[model samples]
Target chain A: MITLHDIGFSYGNNHVLHDITTDFHPGEIVGIIGPSGAGKTTLLRILLGELTPTQGRINNSSSANIAVGYVPQLDSGERTFPLTVEEMVLLGAAAFSRKKPWFDQSEKREASRILERLGILQLRNNRLSELSGGQFQRALIARALMSRPSLLLLDEPTSGIDLHTRQQVLDLVHELQTDGFTIILTTHDLNWVAAQLPRILCLNGTVTGDGAPSEVLTSQVVRETYGANMDVIFHQGRPVVVDSVNNGGNQ
Target chain B: MSYFTDPFQYDFFSRALIVSVLIGALAGAIGPFVLVRRMAYIGQGMSQSILGGVALGVVWGLDLYFGAAVAAGLSAALIYFVRNRGVPVDTAIGIVASTLFAIGVAVVSSSRDRRLNSANLLFGNVLGVDTEDIILVALVTVIAAIVLFRNYKTLLAVTHNSAVAAAHGVRARLMEVIFSALLAMVVVTALRVLGVLLVAATLLIPAATATMTFRTFRNITIASICLGTSFAIIGLFLSFHRNIASGPAIVLVGATVFAMNMLTSTTSQRNRA
Candidate 1:
């Protein structure tokens, strides 16, 4: 389990994250929904132990000793880095045990397994720079899985991709969740997440509400957190958020 | 034939050529890391700072090699320290190197010993590569090569992305220190052959030239070493006949090679386009 208690983080004079207290247990996918600049990234960083909180404490249970695989949002762009997909994934393995001289047969097999699972085994030898939006997201996920971490922290993984690709990526995340990986991903894809993920954390600087998709993504919570007036439409027993403000429809 | 045979048969000349090649190989290998990390300027800065150490040695009548080594090591440590303290690595490097270089120039200007020319320190005396200097450069080159080989993957990961490397459990700060130290070692060893001002070019140019031709990491390294050694040998011969500065000669050869490699790559890219 990953736990944070009363975590307050400040950068210089500005408070980025304030009084965050929560424990994320295993076998459940927690989706954090908030507007931009709402400290969702900072909160994720704090959980990953990448950023030390100015106030409060963090504790990790013995089970979650694996490195928290973080897929950052900002740095990755259309531009390509001079590395292969296999090389990128091998970098994740470099964290655990870099004592071996080379990536042996077993390590190569493991990397291939992850690539196959992510449906990008064919692109294993391809350069990372050549991948499209959805392909790159899947590659990043495969790279993260190379470490075999218990908890995966994805920061806006579905941001720049299109609608069909977004659904496919979220479906993959859902599959991973069902296969028992504690996943916490920050995303602006509220409607998509609401339709798929069971639990939700509606946050804006602080947790506005936390419960099932139905309880957390209400009209009042949406307005308070995102400044968005939207209605949750039940389509075939699934929650689909329809933005009345942006869609130019009668509320 | 007497001039050719005598120099070739002599132990000193053989040692000189071997040492120069070794130094070139070491600089070429470590240089790609420097280029990729965007610390090419640091190599130049550190090389120039070695003049301060040499000037100090001249003033105090101490061993110049030892003095240059100390200076390079200290400057490297300072760069590492500043970087660890969250200062920009390039800023720290620029400050330390330029400051020491200025001090060296000032000290030399004020000194009464008119015999030692600063121009020699800036260029090089490749013909004066004695047996002792050759052995010293060779030993250091071996050590640098071994260190680089041992931590190859870790260094690659660290250079590629520090934050990701850190998250993956690589000691990013420690790797930075190691890389800086290796650079210093290569600079100090190649100081006599390339001189302080132009040593960084020797480190940077050959590696950069090879990168344009080679696509993979392994090939880039091998191609860089070949380019470096070829330039060193040919530059030594040309400088011997033309009576030009060996440092500038070597750099010019590297530049020519770099231009050729770049042209070839551009043509190939255009062909594909």
Candidate 2:
């Protein structure tokens, strides 16, 4: 279990997070949503031990070494190295290999299995530059999964992806949660949050709302989290967020 | 065959041949990372900047490569320090390269009894390559090869994405420092073989050509070394027969190959489209 206690971070003076105390329970999926620069990615970075909190400590009470896997929201638009999709995925296991120069047979098989699970096994030998948007996203996920990580962090997994891919990601998240992997993700898709996420952590430099969609969501909280005039409406007992300004004139 | 084999029978040509081959292989092995990282300018800048160090070595009776290595290392540090204070990388490189090159020119012009030959430093003299020069290049090439082999994957991982590489416990900074140091050594070793004017040509063109021909990083690396070595051999032979400067001949060979690769790859890609 990993818990952040009073985790406040700042970039020299521009404070990003303020006392963000949260924890991820084992075998749970939590979706964090907020506007740009809401420290959603920053929070994930802190959790991954990429950055030390400027204020508090991250408590990982587990005595065992936790294999943490990460899928970034976007790859840099720069031309990536000419690594095959399989090689990119194999990088997930590179850290765990005992300083070996090459991936052994078992590791290669595991990579193939992860690629198959992500539905891009046939495209394994293709260069990363050749992958389409949805294919690239799936490859990123497959790479993360190659580490056999007990904890997974995906930043903006739904951004820049097709709706079909979005649904596939939703289904995959559900499947992974069932497999006892604790997952944390940040997204801008409120509809995805309402439809699937059991818990939502809303943020605007801090935790504005944290609970199930119905309990934590309100027009005030939505405005606070996103800094937009969007309003939430219940559709078939689930919250469907709509821009109130666009639909306000009709009502 | 005799015409080609005749050059190898001479001691100087053979020595120059060995140096150029190692330069090609080393440059090929390392060039793509430099280009992919967008450090081609840095490579050129550092190679030119080392002239000041080399000139100072000539004046003070120090080992040429030692002075070159020190100078390159210092220039990189100074540029980094300047860039950290809000200067752009290109601007920093420009400032450092010009200052050092001017200082080298000043040193060369001021000394009445100077042993330093400007043409040799700028254009290289392949016929002047001695056994010592061959030994120096061979030593550096072996070091570069061993380091590349030991940390190939991690270095490539960092090259892909440093943030992602960090997640795998690869220290990007450490790798960078190692790379820079090795590059400095490579440049120093190349100072007499390729000269300051053409180090980046060998350092980048081979790998750039390979990138178009190969789809995988490993194959690209292998291809780059082969291409670089071939270019060096052919370039040396061309220089021997055509009575041209070895450095320019080598770069011309590499440039020609790169141009041909670009032409074919683009046409093939367009055909596929």
Candidate 3:
């Protein structure tokens, strides 16, 4: 649905993204994995049209206009407003929709349905600050679903989450994929997000590798992308990624 | 009956009361966004910063309202720009507010303009309100209220998270400009009648009390308007009865109500515990 031809971005003299060329086809579950300063979040913002690439053009070659759902890092979205979970979710729709101040019956019902689907219907009236991490992540997902978007962008879904919450988010990604939502998420770790995706883009200041996890998760590309040695060990069918430095020292 | 009806008999006194009520409603209406966005200090800053503009207007023979609006609006835009450019919000506000306030003090103290009465500007003269003041206050109040009501959802969303809203295709920049404009209107309107020292009272105090009183933003806003208007009316009565400036009287009433609300809420929470 979208094609990027040689996109580059810079901050002052620091080039955050360098000649990043890729295509996001329809209904593809893709993961972008990179180190802390690899501009993963910057790239996500670029795709969301929130930030303009300092160079190159992004072509939305698809004939039909695509709607996008964006879930920012859960901790970053504002909690200062006296917003209920349902109200926050509905804001996704309201941002795209210039409806009346008072929500219509259908919008309210839709918000309720999404909350129920996310197992947060009981928390529909709870404030954003009142939610736990897992619940907040779920709330963000529910908010994204409010737009019924075909394309969803999640930034750092597991960066600050506990193991259980991480598993829940991974499961949510799986469920969203099954429901025909084209999901793209960014993560610094490979075992969490990249390993689960059908395809992964390894980035460090640019696109280091782009392909399936098996084809691209080779130790060479992993080292190149992360600037450190990482062991890509296969057990049965799944790949177990371990820090080579940590593993070697322990052994 | 004679004592109660005494103030209402005078035409100027009635005008002052009506204008104060309008100021209360508008200030209250815009206050929640201020509190929620945590821009109360900015509101206070802009209010005082307008003193410089009023001084400049007097020295240059310009309309005081126009000068104050320009100053307040410019300050808001400047602060937003600086903050967006990576300056911390507090630092940006602090620098802008203090510089403008200092300039105003310098201008007022130096210019010796007979029309620039420091006492009236600082405390506001309730008896000084005229017909044009009534018309201006009414127009601004009604328009601001209607605009706020119509765009509450969009404003709420943008205020919460502009980046997220932008992803959903909202023009966050435009919403911000409108918010700044609305804020300027509230401050400028209140500045003329309430004085800079007391403008925050109409805004921060009532809105703060409303938030303490209600759970939903809508309820809090409605409560703020009700509380603000009540404070204005009661304050106006007290001002007339005690021969105090209306601005100080209104602030005193608002402060009292805010204290009461805080006390009761604390008691209720303790009881529940």
Write down the DockQ of candidate 1.
Answer: 0.39
Best by DockQ: 3
Minimal lDDT window, size 10, model 3 chain B: B111-120
Q: State the lDDT of candidate 2 residue by residue for B49-157, as single tens digits.
A: 9999989987998988888988998899999999999999999999998899888888978876445778778777787788888988898899888888878877777
lDDT of 1 by residue, B1-273 (tens): 654455476564566577778878888888777777667788898898888888888788878787888898878777778888888878888888998899788878888765345776788766567878877887787787777776777777778777666666677788887888888888888877787888899888988887766655556777888888988887776666577877888889889888987998899999999
DockQ scores for all predicted structures: 0.39, 0.52, 0.68
Give the Å shift of residue B99 in candidate 2. 2.3
Error of 3 at B24 (Å): 1.1
The candidate 2 chain A region of ten consecutive residues with least summed lDDT is A242-251
How many Å off is the CA of A89 in candidate 1? 1.8
lDDT of each: 0.78, 0.85, 0.84
Backbone clash total for model 1 is 0
The residue pairs that clash in candidate 3, if any, are none
Q: Distance from true position, residue B165, model 3, in Å? A: 0.8
What is the number of backbone collisions in each predicted candidate, taken in the order shown?
0, 0, 0
Per residue, candidate 3 scores C-alpha lDDT tens digits across A1-251 of 78888999988899999899999987788999988999999999889987799999998877766788988886644655677888889988876565457888888899998888888899998887788888988988888888778899998888777988888888888888888888999887687654578899999999999988877887788788878777888766666678786545222
Cα miss at A69, model 3 (Å)? Answer: 0.9
Q: What's the TM-score of every candidate structure?
A: 0.87, 0.94, 0.94
